[model samples]
Target: MIKSYFIQNKSKDLKSFKAMLMWIIIFTFTTILSFSQETPYYQLPKNRKQNHEMIVMPNLDAFTITYFLSASAGIRKPFVQQNGISPSAASFEAPANGFWEIALGQNRNDNWIYEFGITKSNNRLKTSFLELSRTPLVFTNEIEQYYAPFRIKKKILTLDKVSRNAFLNIGLGVSYLIKSNNKPIEEGKITFGQRPIPEPRDYTSLNFRIASSNQPIAFELLTEVRGKVSERLEISVFGKAFFRNNKYLNNQFSFTYVDGSSKEFGNYEKPISILFGLQAKFNSPKYYQYKSRVE
Candidate 1:
């Protein structure tokens, strides 16, 4: 009876030991899984403003240069006969004005840019008188002008896959006429050379220069298509418009012949003009990296 009792007790102890071993294995596995699923104690904040260890840098964006040509729609004028001899109709033609500009630009925000720049421009005019029985008479005028413009541009479209952008800009400008020359053309030969001289006594006088109005205020508008050419360079083609409520850049001119006949040409006003141009913009890599960091 003692031997049988000892066997039963030994079996009970063995089963208890097996059950205890199973419980210990399950507990160890569960503890390991909980530890593996835990997050790190320290993490970085996703918001830039909330990050205390982040550095802030200045954002200086780009420098740009542009060259443009103007297109003017010529207007016709009439001849005034003093000696009872009315000549045939006269017509006025003004060629395109060429302009060059250099500007510095700053990114005002994600979709806007601001630019301030100076432009150099020159205007030329050609006038012809068509008489019934006489050779046509021609007159010419030339002027060099300068202006400063402040503009803000908005991005209308952005194509990141192609690295291209389109923008529209509007701004205000002031123009100054520095030099001018006007002369009559005889037998298709230009009479005088356009050169700098001492300030003429009548430089700003009425009817002496092509423009009667000087230093006029201008409103400017521009549209651009820009593409990235390299890490530091971008290329663009643009169209621009200017609205100046002055006599500047007018196709109109009045001249008197040696035979006492007077003629007036054009519509006597040039309120708006158009220009098309090419631009090259340079960027700094250091500033470009700042764009990536903030984004």
Candidate 2:
């Protein structure tokens, strides 16, 4: 009877241990689920709370480089053509040229844009002269000059009817003659029976001061219409008018021909030039920002 009582107590102890093990498992699972709800690995969109909005900062400073092809036109009298008695002014005409520029720009609250840049242009000037009667001299001269311009432009007017980014600007700049192909008269002179008709270089005065400090200063009026192609690429069409002081010579050159013929052959003034061009501008994507909205 004592043995039987011990067996019954042992069975009761085993049942109690199974019940305790089940309770411990349930408690552990509950604690883990509670912690997971508080701190999750990733948050879902539906679980996000209200009153949290993302903000994007504006791009205040950006850099751009432009490659453009422009055509220039002006009635600039840079040389003189003379026959026997009457002297006339010969105008120089320019063809289309290419320019490369690098600029840094500042955007002010999407209202105004300020730009400063350095540009270089390769230009060709053409003019022809004909003395069809007396000396029978006929010739055409083509001259080349390289210009390096440092400029700053400020926005003056915005055309809201045309586009959001269309604007007019006024520019102040200075340009230096980096190099020129001006040859001496002795190489291309023509002799007519003891009178030597010198080349254009002999009649045109040379500028001894060709440095950057002695560059020509100018003001420009320009209008630009820009279109965005992508986040980093933009295309623009622009028209500019440049009003500059004398770009080359300051005084005229007077030369006496072989038959006691004298004429003034140089003009110290530069005319107003107009330019029309298309440009492509590039910028970095880091200068722009994108925002996400969560409601």
Candidate 3:
């Protein structure tokens, strides 16, 4: 199907077709070279097969750990799935992140990968105080921009043994925000990071309606596929999701107003919030070593 599609558009998409053709040739050549040497390469020694046959995943004759960096584009909604009232300041529409990965395992089959990532947003909601008087004065809302999403991930499913052409991997991760800006909120109560909380870190406050804690940890999951374009380069496609633990990450800023009776807001939090994103990855070989299990 794909071959015919490309063939049909060969004339119309000449440039694109040419580019695609070039990559195909490069990948084919690289695959041949990866295992071709005067003495032969990437072939398992007969003696070592017995020891590795019991393993669930495929093994490589010689392989090394892979390192990568990726850029992510996605969304981060409130911890609560829905709210009777909107957020006081948070209107997170687009979320972005940068991640680093360290992978260990057989290059062609499965591997254990460790990951670290950080996310943040520049969008801020601004509302102002209003007064109905002879002359109306505008009090623009000054909401702070929130960020600092740190995550750790582990890849459980990987199809690297087939990487001479393409590969796939799936992973799970988590994010924690328990330190730095931490506080509770009530309908009419104020939390940390809001005004008077001081400059620099005031943006991390809980001064919004239906707001949760500064540290409502979230769970993350991802799937990625890489296509070899050349011996040293591969292109990737990926999808990821983040689900907040509402049971532990509830809404703390879900409040209205407390004339004077309401002072202290409870410690309880408010619901499930989900965030997701998609990304493209560009990978290149960092280094390669010739190793043999048996001499």
Model 2: colliding residue pairs: none
* Model 3 lDDT per residue over 1-295, tens place: 9998888888678888789999999999988776575223323343234323323223435444445555656554432232333323232221222332322222332245454545543221222212222343222211222333443334444455543355666777666543333234324433432445344422232233333334446666777675556544445566666554442333323323222222112222223334455544344443334444455
On TM-score, the stronger of 1 and 2 is 1
Tens digit per residue, CA lDDT, model 1, 1-295: 9999999999999999999999999999999887766522222222333212222332322332232222222222211112222234666565675678777776543256666666777665555657522677555555566666667767776655333343444443444433334333222222322236523321111122333346446676777766656535667677767776655444444334433455444533365677777777775532222233333
Per-residue alpha-carbon lDDT of candidate 2 for residues 1-295, written as tens digits (9 for 90 to 100) = 9999999999999999999999999999999998898654324323433212111222223232333322233222232222222243334344455555556555443344555555555434443234423443323233355555555556666655443445555555656556566533312333333327654433332111111113445556666666556535667677777665543323233444434555644323244666666666564432323333433
Worst 10 residues of 3 by lDDT: 260-269
lDDT of each: 0.51, 0.46, 0.42
Q: Cα miss at 201, model 2 (Å)? A: 25
Off by over 4 Å in 2: 1-96, 131-189, 194-216, 247-261, 265-269, 286-295
Question: lDDT score, residue 215, model 2?
Answer: 40
Model 1 C-alpha lDDT versus the unseen true structure: 0.51
In model 1, where do residues sit more than 4 Å from their true spots?
Answer: 1-86, 132-135, 161-211, 249-269, 286-295
lDDT of the structure predicted as candidate 3: 0.42
Please give the distance, in angstroms, between residue 164's alpha carbon in candidate 1 and its true position after superposition: 6.5
How far is 3's C-alpha from truth in model 1 (Å)? 29
